[model samples]
Target: MAEAARGLGWHPFPGPAAVNSVRYQNRAACAYHGFCDRGGCHLDAKNSTAVSTIPRAQETGRLQVVTEAHVRRVEVDGEGRATGVSYLKGGEEYFQPADVVLLASYTYENVRLMLLSKSPAYPDGLSNNGGQVGRHYMTHATGAGVLALFPHRLNRWYGLPAQGVAIDDWAADNFDHSDLDFIGGGNLWVYSDRRPIAAARMPTFGRAPRWGSAWKAFVADNADRWTNCYIQKSTLPYEDNYLDLHPTVTDPLGDPVCRITADFKDNERRIATFVQDRMVEWFRAAGAVEIIRQGLGTMGPSTHAYGGTRMGDDPETNVVDRWGFSHEAPNLGILGASVMGTSGSHNPTLTAQALGWRTAAHLVENWSSIAG
Candidate 1:
């Protein structure tokens, strides 16, 4: 695949991942057991905070992790500064006070929590006096995939999702877009992470029936003879695409849930169509006898959700300042993809973590002024 991509003047390389390839920080390397896609790694090689950072923080004897607590809102004082957070635990409501508050929930919940925490000083919501809390929303333009069928076995039974070859020539501003209708491109990724149940569910490519003997025969023969490519495109925030508290639907706790009003604009559709063509070309070069292309469906709930509490220099257009602190609430900080203004052609996990470290460092450096 790398050779094929190189032949097309594209940059092909191994996809960057957080999973450990060798022993590091006392954690074992990835076992490549093929189930890393389904759940947490028993070997603790995935580099999740649970095994990496939290444990180290707990070792300091200063960090307390309260499990099963549902945070209700961020409590504020008369001056509209965050005092602490109120949460529900075991049917009892409790407030935990703090000198500084950092909201690190995923994009949706972060926005919802800020919106739900309405105060008399800030009548709209916490840090929402400028109405920018849930304004610039975005999700990665993903799910536009291509499946390829090969004639021989690919020996792809034991690999992880991060174990993949990637083509980044078409990803984000890498190529000239002088004549293109879209501004951003996509990253093409091909990995050999396959599971038995998902492999058995592969489409027959119109060569067999949907059930019975023919389907069984097809699955038996072609189970290991197919692979798919994931295309993650750059997505931009739009004015109309935003998140808000749902007016009608409420959760079990009688609080409104986060509502997403977003779709793939024409620019995104053009990028998907263009990237899919390139993907098909690459698959053909890699000896794919059959190729199946999926549509550029509407953006739905995604693990790569971004924005809602975007960071910027202007208070009128952003919820948080450049340091990830709330623009209106001085001591409140946000530490997640929710503060990201744009969705690049990659996963936001590393970027989010980097920002979290930066925000924490900033808080520590300016503790007297920020936490006063």
Candidate 2:
């Protein structure tokens, strides 16, 4: 890992190790733009769209990426065909005509833009006449695992959030849930020491006195003693949980922000509970003196969030076709995790990238069929 960083002309943090896994908490540690970890990667070392596909797409002069281009709506012709996009580029309003208008933005953002783009052809919103634009928003149900103390120092502070080993014995189809009450399961992981700023946020278990001597002692004794266990549970889509336009709030460019409303169902709770118990067992086997298993918290904006514009064979049930093409607006293509029908146990990045490449390929092959 150090050699890889050095090859990229990025210096690793001091006291680097060959391998380490830190807790990521399923946060947007790296979002679409850059590394969103404890602090933004100043040198942009994290592999994100800004460093990867966006550049390749730019290399082709045919592909134009308008940064700070907030698309307000998808313009459609009289026959209900997508012709172009109306957007704000550098505080100036402009309309760019395209043979096809692809929605390659993030999941929630895609739905939000669709809802805000109301037209006579799409009275409710663009490509949303079925009211299914924001219908199936979902994120995995994951809880943190806590480790008390071990005999030796693992020195876990100097590794990427996902560089360590993961135990996927219980993830997705790997486990038999026949006798269990839930339909899904999670992957258990034991990561390296939690960072200082992140570690301070822990409960302290009421063991550390808040004031002087005891607090200092607690901090000194347990700073590097903790480990992180995370469970990446499967999330099923439901009718009630979804994303929609937030009428109350809008971005700087006058576009509505996406609002999420969802709660963990019984199935998710069961999976979370089962994984927490297993994590405790693993920590015990790893010689943890004490463990603080995290309880399931309220669902919110998840990095692995998916399923606002689903892909399927049926037009009534799904927005995009299997190839991620809009059924109503033939020329428009929707990319990213939003088209996924099921949330795989792993992170969505690799899958999204795979799908992106696949979608781009399909476009290249069937260019006339889709673009016409």
Candidate 3:
């Protein structure tokens, strides 16, 4: 891939060193033939749960795989302890009893399920005694790369996201932000994962009309000449930015959908502008012909949503304790990005997986104390 990049007479620089904490085999040194980011590895070379953890757990005779179970709520006994969960399979309802229960759903769903499960012991919501279940919700403010025009075809049709170059000089607290308006920072990514179908969709640099013959010609002419600059910025949680069950909106299962109320603040806008300046500097240094900067739009519910069930020692402010166990509901553990307190300007999946491991280990080490 480096040789192919150099063949186009490009600088082919390794922007910076960043480690990807993936559970699977390292793709950074692999052939990286473009499609690894999409439908996953065809050869099952990736170490996802389906290929790695699940199969090992299935080897144990005690593991039972229940498919198509839509969990409604975690049932608690009169003493405010989790007894088990109630879920739906097909059109019938079933109750599964257990000594301990872990809510491993995504950020929004984790809070949603907790809010949905109510009992006389805790009227407001499950584990919401201090009303902090959905507070401090946040997501990493994602910025797509500046759609830049390259001077020549770099043959960007090959390579994966893991094979990309990254510039972290502006990410997190790498540089001084005391004089700046924003408190957080972002990482700059330059990937060569240009698929043909995606490259054909670049806006025609105002050279031709957006529709009709001119548009078609422009796409064909500039398909290889266009690329992007991606920035993943650290976003801090605010009191107003939160997640809650939608008042009127219901899902197919008659449950309230998780409603997200978040948007990019002035701090993020300032950071985006600053990151754009730095990206332009790097791109111009790399011989980019044209750079078009974009804004940090309103945030939407993404896989990276965090902090709804934050983990901390204080029960008044956080939902889960430092070990991912609920402060109010004993034997109830949460294992997802929701327990995260900070947005680290990177993908949270690997960190969440590690936290899940830590939570499981903690449970096993203190099983007798917790379950009893």
Off by over 4 Å in 2: 1-38, 142-144, 200-207, 252-255
lDDT of 1 by residue, 1-372 (tens): 898888888889999878999999999988888567767789998978989999999999999999899999999999999999999999999999999999988899999999999999788889999998888799886567899999899888887888899998899999999999888899999986787888898988878899999899999999999998889988889999999999999999999999999887999899999999999999999898999999886675667999999999989999999999998999999999999999989989999999999999999999999999
Per-prediction TM-score, please? 0.97, 0.85, 0.89
What value of lDDT does candidate 3 attain over all alpha carbons? 0.79
RMSD (CA, Å), candidate 1 to true, equals 1.2
Q: Judging by lDDT, tell me the better candidate of 1 and 2.
A: 1
lDDT of 3 by residue, 26-46 (tens): 333334565566567654555
For residues 1-372, write the lDDT of model 2, one tens digit per residue: 233334434333333222212323222233222123445554444556665457776888766767888788889987778889988887799999989777888898888877887778888887887788888888876564455565566576665555545566677777677889988777665554356676655455557877688887876777676667657788888888899988889887666788898887888887777877766666666566667766675464666889889999988988999888887788889999999888866678778878888888889899998878
Task: Say what the RMSD of model 2 is.
Answer: 7.5
lDDT comparison, 1 vs 3, better candidate: 1
Q: What is each predicted model's overall lDDT from 0 to 1?
A: 0.91, 0.72, 0.79
lDDT of 1 at 255: 98
List candidate 3 stretches off by more than 4 Å: 1-41, 211-214
In model 1, the clashing pairs are none
lDDT, candidate 2, equals 0.72
